[model samples]
Target: MSEIIRRDPRAEWIARNRLHPLHAALQSQNQTVWIGPNGIVRKNPHAIAAGFIGPAGIKRIDRSGAQQGTGTRRSASVEVQLPLHVVEQPAYYVAVVPDMVGGRLSSHDKDLLGLARRLAGSEGAVLAVVFGEHKESAFDSAGVDRLLLLDGEQYQGYAPEQRVLALRAVDNQFAPRHWLLPDSRTGGGELGRRLAASLGERPATRVWQAEGERCVGRAGAGQQDIQRPLARLILAAAECAEPVSETRHEARPVELAWQVARNLPRIEDLGPVAVDPAQIPMAEAEFILSGGNGVKDWELFHRAASALGATEGASRVAVDDGHMPRSRQVGATGTWVTARVYLAVGISGAIQHLQGIGACDKVVAVNLDPGCDMIKRADLSVIGDSSAILQALIERVAAWRQEGRRDAA
Candidate 1:
């Protein structure tokens, strides 16, 4: 047997660092550093240093162009291009506000802010357009550079027409190049598609990554990953993780025009519908117990979910068979879940079903077939009849409770 030799990882790093453009630029003494749009180089080396170090670390360069000591930094001067006729000044960044159900910002909102911050970098400002009630402090703490609040009764509710009108008003004022909206069941995706059509611009849905002008995300039913430039109007659906602490900035309010508000078509407001917590939509459920084609008894499925304190969900087959409501269906053609824990019962796990549960933190599968797709995808798999396992689990849970009571006595 011949001995194998391993290449040092540092070799690749060394090669990459050597090929870096910044290294060559720094080495060239005659290389002029353009600060902004005009390509003007300042006489003061300190200003040049400030541009790279973000107006905080000012370094004193001697006559020989060597750093001597550090001094107080000043904000770098960069000129913004003014909007012209037919063409407008490109927006630094724009985040479209959706009506936050239950007066709370979801993970989508936090993710939008995160995406804005990443895109804005140091040169551009992060702008958020609010339609409904949102705390200025919340946005400020999230590091929003500018906030355009369209607060009033007119902007209230889940009216798509009203949202479109508000967005158009914002567009007329700012003409943002990039637009970020939350990817949720509540009208954001529809709003984005409609806005894109109305504005005659290309839109990207369910974007996960953004690099400079290019955004990469799933396109259609096949979940094909596509990349498109951010040069023109870019509308992206934000799918974000939990927010971390960011540097807080003061939020400046932008006023909405009274004429713009008045021009929107009148729509009658219907009051909120009463819904049972047990019957909560699967998409918004934290814990879900989902059944599929293999599940024979619908009552048993509901019983299992009730015992586990989970929301009831169903695969397309189960829904189509009338075992569950369409609202409870989890798949490409149904509601997408972001559940903390999803217990899949008797599901073979089609690609469409997997797509719906993409955001689920953990998946547990109970099926007779050990080689099933759901079993493969699940974190924990029980190779058994789903109803039998569910019944066993229910019995075990009841016994545990009884034991606890007996111990207390």
Candidate 2:
């Protein structure tokens, strides 16, 4: 009797697609050992099913997927360059002021840019007005047609008055058809209101939809929808429109025609005050250390979070078990976080939890189960005991802080 081999091309394709929703699960099943881009070899001990016991009762192990002469492997390193959307001589401009939190564009900022692109249409340009020093390097992909940087000492810190002055100067030069800003607590909402007051233009607030001449926004505590003619300025809510993913823009730099007029400072610029990570709101947190059912030591977990300077988050099960407060829970039913780094310890990565951290830039998972959902979504995965990992992490962070102090001395 001969053996028959089977192949599933669809499964292989899904495994190679990093953007697919099932990518993590499919890859976890198909791969046991793989080389990362940094030349580090990662192995999944639980996925070592490449061979079976022979008739002689001798176990066989094959690194290659070739079982019974039928196996396939594929890579997902091919980069697809989007088509360029060029506006040579724009008839008008739709200026957008993004809330570049932590010197980089947030998901809110990108959503606002997507709305700006819609307003610009085919003939007009999307002018991005940036403030202070920025670390963003992908302006072209973010759909910026004209980049206007207002980087100055005056624009730094909590200077809404100074920012309004710069925006007024932009108004005099470009005279854009419309102004768009994010309607969040982050600097954008306040700045937009100030700009509207400074320019004496009635602005639409909490706007979610915009079309040819009319825009719809939330009114009366978000229970009612008000439709009105599009105002000169608009403060849009998050998810106003889909982000620009199909096309790239020029991101051409533009300079102001004249120097910005300065004014007497009313608010003194005091340096930032250090706040505890647990006190920070989940939506506004930049780094999070989350724990799940696999975490056995709650006291050590808290210590590790404090040492790492990360906001504490917990899984639904942890919260239900009274291990953490409901406010610190991270999932679809809980607060959605847009942290730059989300560290999950012993989490199985529920669908709701993954949805909550979908906007995070990086996800690092520490778990005993290599085939867990969290490991699939993690940018880096460490298969180990949660308590040991946390203890080592706390020690490492303490040593790093001590070295820094010594260097200063």
RMSD of every prediction:
16.1, 10.8
Off by over 4 Å in 2: 1-75, 406-409
Q: lDDT of all predictions, in order shown?
A: 0.67, 0.87
State the TM-score for model 1. Answer: 0.47
Question: How much lDDT does candidate 1 score?
Answer: 0.67
Report the C-alpha lDDT of model 2 over 224-304, residue by residue, as the tens digit: 999999988999998888777777899999999988877789999788889999889998899999999999999999999
Alpha-carbon error at 245 in model 2, in Å? 0.4
What local lDDT does model 2 show for residue 34? 82
Q: Which ten residues in a row have the lowest lDDT in candidate 2?
A: 72-81
**lDDT tens string, model 1, 1-409?**
7545455556535433533323333343332354433455535354443233321123334355332245433223443222211102224555555435444455567677777667766656667776767533466556566777666777666577777877887888776656777656776777777777877877776777778767777667636888776534444455543242435554566675545666455667686685554767676787899999888877877787777778888899998888887888898899999886899999998989989997776799999987677877799999987778889988988898899999999
